[model samples]
Target: MVTYRSAGVDIDKANEFVKFIKEKVKKEFNLEEFGGFASGFPIKGYKKPILFSTTDGVGTKLKVAQAVGVHNTVGIDLVAMNVNDLITTGADPFIFLDYIATGKLDLEVMKQVMEGIIKGCREGEVILAGGETAEMPGFYPEGVYDLAGFCVGLCEEDEVITGKEIKPGDLLLGLPSSGFHSNGYSLIRKVLEMNNVSYEDYVEELGKKVWEVLLVPTRIYVKEIKKLKKNVKIKGIAHITGGGIPENLIRILPEGTKAVVYKKNIPQNPVFSWIQRLGNVEEREMFRTFNMGVGMIVILDKEEFDKARELIPESFYLGEILAGRKEVEIL
Candidate 1:
């Protein structure tokens, strides 16, 4: 008669891991009267408050983490992806929850992961209110884990920046990404493995190991953009992830307006070019798959372009909004 622990699902270890995380997770909070339920925020000034929420996972990047046996950074990637999406709608992320499922319980690995999560919450100015961890023996291979995050944000109803205000002649500002970000890794892994490329290999252009470039943590733009909100007239914010520029930017465009991205102005990270060449991937496919160096974009009036630039120093003036169908044009 085999028991659950014998079957590779250790309930005792899972419980012990949870007990360890409780203290570390509390470091993400400063409130003395922190409620035991979902997180709560003080809403005093906003006449009409609107809640913003988003849930996201790190995608196939998990494969990279598994390949490298590095787990902490992916946890930060999970939080950044979800909280960054929350801020796109001009929401201030206040609380975050995470879900971790693994084939077996590993306290050491879970502790490292939770540390990254706590770091992300601190950077995004959010509280890690609650989360779940599950150990399923047959669901995943040993040493493999999956992570997802849920975030809730707050904004005044009247102040939500839903692109309704985006108009023709609005300037498009592109924020630089760290690397491939959290998308297109399925193709990346396939291309690398098929070509017998190891993450340890060094590319001259990147001046580092392949996995180092691939693992560069996703940028958290919430803190920077939130500062700009005080004075800038930001019409909309787009978090460019899986769909790349054209698909992601179009989501925030108003019905009558379209976004025109100047391909020349779009910065290309060397890692992307290396991937394209390695796999003989097409240019269009490259644009569709990777962030291509522009991780987040801000749409605002042309007059505010200078101020926007001042706020985000490394950003590029990608293009502008135009009177057209709700589509995006790459000129």
Candidate 2:
């Protein structure tokens, strides 16, 4: 008789993985959000409390982690992807759930992934409420896995940063990215393959192995943005991800205002130039496809520019808001 395990699904192994995760969660996460069919988190004491949530996957950046055999940080990327999205809406991250699917259950590999999640939760100051792990043998190749994260953030109705007030003459302040934050890996991989570059190959300009550079997990702006909210009047916040600054910044832009990002003003990260040179990709495509150097953008009135600078002294003056249609011009 055929069994589920024979068909590339392992129920017992999956159960074991769940058991392990339960122990980890109990130890590392805030127990107040623990022990519920649906994780229970209280949202009391906020005036007009609202729930902000986002679900996101790591995309092709997972492939880079697999290529490098570095599984720990992609889980952090998973959490960052969702938590960062929540903060853009001016929400304080409260809880996170993760989904893991793979061909066969590899405890060590998944442990590495979960370790990163714990670290990410700590950094973002969120709880690991609950999650699911699936062993789909036929669906995924052996040694390959994928992760998706769901996050819930709490914010007051009035404080929700919808970017509706963004207008001409506002300043575009850019926060620096550590590296490519878990996006645009499909194009990045293609360039590497076409150029015969392996993860281990050292690029002089980048000063690291190809995969080492690519697997740098996404940065979680939860704590920083939360702090900024208390001290600064954040008109809009854009967590630049898959679409880069042009596509992302435009999302928060008001109908009458546009974003002007000066190319020279951008603190260009080296990996972008390396990839552009290798792929012969145009400047526009580069900005459209990758975050380049800018990670998160904070938009505020020109009058509040110094206030923002006072808070984030190292923030770069990317460009200025302009009177135009709702789009971005990366000059």
Candidate 3:
């Protein structure tokens, strides 16, 4: 007779992992039925609540974390990616769930990853509702795992920002990013590999090792967006990801209006310059691949620009809308 354990799946280990998670999050989050088939969260305090949901992964940035033996920050990256996208719709994220899969469960590494996730949830003010941990011996290589996160948020029906009000003469404001926030690492890895550079190698320009820069957790803009919306009539919002500014920002532009981003206005991250010099990447590709420096963009009326600055001192004047095709231009 064949047993389930003989097939490489360890039931006892998975049970223990679940128990560990419950113990860590029991006090922090008020999820009484976390281990059940599904988690529950009560929604209240909205006149006409609109639900928003998003899911995202850490991308190849995971490789850098694994290579560097840093497993914690990637969990934060997972939460940031999902929550940041949810906030782009001007929603308040209230619950978060994660799925982690590995060949053989490494309790210590998974624990570290959970810690990071908990930290991100706390920072974003989202509840750690529940999640899953899958252990398949033959499915994934030993000591290797993948992570994905799901987030649910809600906003008042009247408060949803859909970029319908965006028009010519509106000003664009940008929130600076924390290095390359969980995107374009595949190209980054390629650049390093082709040049025979290791993640452990130090780059003087960046003042840090390669993995250090690569593993920088993505910024969670939930709080900042909430603060700005109360004071400014935010016409549009964009979370710069996978496709740099042009691809992400264009999604929020109204018809007949285009965005022009002044290169001079952008405070480019040093890592981008180093990558360009090392990989001989074109300027257009650099802007297309990386966040450059700006992580989030807020579009509002020109009259409100001063007020926005007072609220977010770190935000810079990015560009303005123009009467043209619905698109984005990085000058």
Candidate 4:
């Protein structure tokens, strides 16, 4: 007689793995009263509070983690993808929950994954309230795992920074990215493998193993942007991800206001160039798939440019909002 364990799922091992992660997971909790049936938050003082939430996954970048046998940083990617989006609406991320599904239980791997999640949550100033981990034998391949995260944040209704305030003459400020933050991997993997390049190989420009460049953890922009929000009048915040500059930035543009991006003014990271050459990818396609060095953008009136500049020194004047169709143009 065949059993679930024989089919590559080990129920006992999966339960044991959860038991091991309880301690590590508890480290993200700050509640003094620990025995609640549901996650709790105390909201008392705000006159008008607005709640913001988002859910996201790391995309096919998990395949890169599985390829390189690096399980931890992907967990950070999982959290960063979700919480970063929550902050775009000027929300203060308050709590996060994760979902992990795998073919079998690997305690060591799960521990490292949880550690990264906890570290990411702490950095974002949010609580890791709860999560679910599932082991499905027939569903996933052995050694492969997938992760997704849900985030909730709070802000006052009047304080929400929707793009409604954006108008012509507003300055666009870009924040530099460490590298590609969990997008465009399907094409990247295809090109690299076709060229017989392995993660172990070092490219001169990257200055480390290829996998290191591929696995650069996604940047958490919540802290920096939160600081800027306090002192600057930000009209809109755009988190550059899968849709790249034009598509992503235009999401927050008000109708009749187009964002004119000066391509020359935008900085290009070497990895982007390398990928372009390797994949023979078109410039337009590259802009649509990757962050292309600028990971997040802030839009505010031209009058606030100098003040906003002081708050975010790394930002660059990418371009301006103009009275035109709701489109992004490269000048």
Candidate 5:
């Protein structure tokens, strides 16, 4: 008879790993029905609520973590990847689940990963409802794993912040990024290799090791955006990820409106300038790939500028919306 273990898949080991997580799930999550095929999340009281969800991975940030021997923070990166997108629609994320695939199951490493996930969940105010762990011996290298997460949120139909309300006179307010919030790492890795710089090398500009700079977990903007929604007439929000400010901003822009982001106006981290010169990367490529500094873009109505300014007093004046076609331009 054919067997599963011979095919490099460990079913029993996966079960044992889940066994370890279940006890903690009950104690920490109050989840009695933990190990079922699907998880149950209890949410209620949505009068005209619409559900929003997103699935995302941390990209090559995981490789940076592997090269640095740090796994904890990437779990936060994983959670941030999904929940940040959910918040773009002005929805409150209620629950999230993770998928972890590995060549081998290292319980210690897995535990550390879970630690960051729990921490991220607390930051986003979302529960870690359930997750899956798979061990495929040949698929991934030993001591390496990949993580992705799915997040679901709820918001009233009328409360959605779609950029349809954006107009020519609107201003774009940008929130500062902690670092390269979990995107462009593949190119970053390429840049590193081209420069022959090791992850352990300390760069004076960053005042830290290379891996530490690259592995900084993505910021979860769920709480901040929700707070701003209460005080400001936020026409739309763009979670700057892989596409950076230019691509992500356009996602929410209404027709006949163009967003012009001024490069000099953004508060940039020194590391970006360092990398740009080192990699010979152009400005448009920098804006398209890395966040360059702005992690989240908030489009505020001209009338609500004062109230919004009061809220994010230090927000960088990225640019203004202008009457044009549905597109984004860097000024």
Candidate 6:
């Protein structure tokens, strides 16, 4: 007689993992119940609320985390990717859910990942609603796992920033990224392999080991955007991710307006320069692949630029919008 445990699927272990998640959510989010089929929270304070949802995964960056035996930061990356996108519409993310899957259960690793998730939720002011932990025997390797996150946000109907307000003469403002911010790791790993570089190896330019820089948790822009909203009238916002500035910035432009960005003013982070030197990557490819440095771009009227700058001192004056075909130019 074969049992589920004998077949490498331990129902008891999965139950225990669910209980573990419940405890974490209870402590972190002050929830009285968890492990439910669906999670929810009541909404308030908006006379006319519009709901926005976003889903994203950490992508190949998870492989790097597994390689380095660090499972925490990627949880933050998961939340950052989703919440940042939701906020572009001027929504306040209120609830977040996560999904984790692996070939076998590892309690300790899951716990560490959960801790990072809780931290990220707290920082983003999102509730740890609920999540799923699947242990699939044949689908994944024993030590490898994957993560995906879902975020829901609420905004007033009149307050939604649809980018329709963005027009010619609006100034582009760029907020610096924490690092790579969970994109382009496939190319990064390939570059490392071609250079015969190890994640443990330290490079002089970046001032840290490869894995350390790569593992830097993506910055959550919720607080900064919220603060800026109070003082500045932001016409549009873009979260720079896989497609980089050229692809992301163009997204918020109106049909006839174009964006012009000054590459010289981008304040290229050291890691990008290192990757370019090692991989011999072209400038265009680099901009299209990585954030280069800016993580979030905000569109504002020329007159409001001074106030927005005063609020976010680290922001750089990227460029201005102009009348043209819908596209982007990085000079």
> Which model scores highest in lDDT?
6
Q: What is the lDDT, from 0 to 100, of the residue 38 in candidate 2?
A: 76
Candidate 2 local Cα displacement, residue 53, angstroms = 1.0
lDDT of all the models against the reference? 0.86, 0.86, 0.91, 0.86, 0.85, 0.92
Native-to-model Cα distance after best TM-score fit, residue 16 in candidate 3, in Å: 1.8
Residue range with the least summed lDDT across 10 consecutive positions in model 4: 28-37
TM-scores, in order shown?
0.94, 0.95, 0.97, 0.94, 0.94, 0.97
lDDT (tens digit, per residue) of candidate 5 on 21-125: 787667776768877888766557878989999899888888877776788898898889898889989899988999998998887888878888877888888
Clashing pairs in 6: none
Give lDDT tens digits, candidate 6, residues 49-153.
999999999999999999989998999999999999999999999999999999988888988898889899988999989888888898998799999999999
Q: What global local distance difference test value does model 5 have?
A: 0.85
Note each model's CA RMSD in angstroms.
1.9, 1.7, 1.2, 1.9, 2.0, 1.1
Predicted structure 2: clash tally: 0
Stretches > 4 Å off in candidate 5: 1-13
* TM-score-better candidate, 4 vs 5: 4
Sliding window of 10 residues with minimal summed lDDT for model 3: 24-33
Q: In model 4, which regions exceed 4 Å deviation?
A: 1-12, 32-37
* Model 2 lowest lDDT segment of ten: 29-38
* Candidate 4 structure quality by residue, lDDT tens digits, 71-147: 88988888899988999999999889889999887878888888888888877888888788888877888898889
Which is superior by TM-score, 5 or 6? Answer: 6
Instruction: Please identify model 3 stretches exceeding 4 Å from their true place.
Output: none
Model 2 TM-score on a 0 to 1 scale = 0.95
Off by over 4 Å in 2: 1-7, 32-36
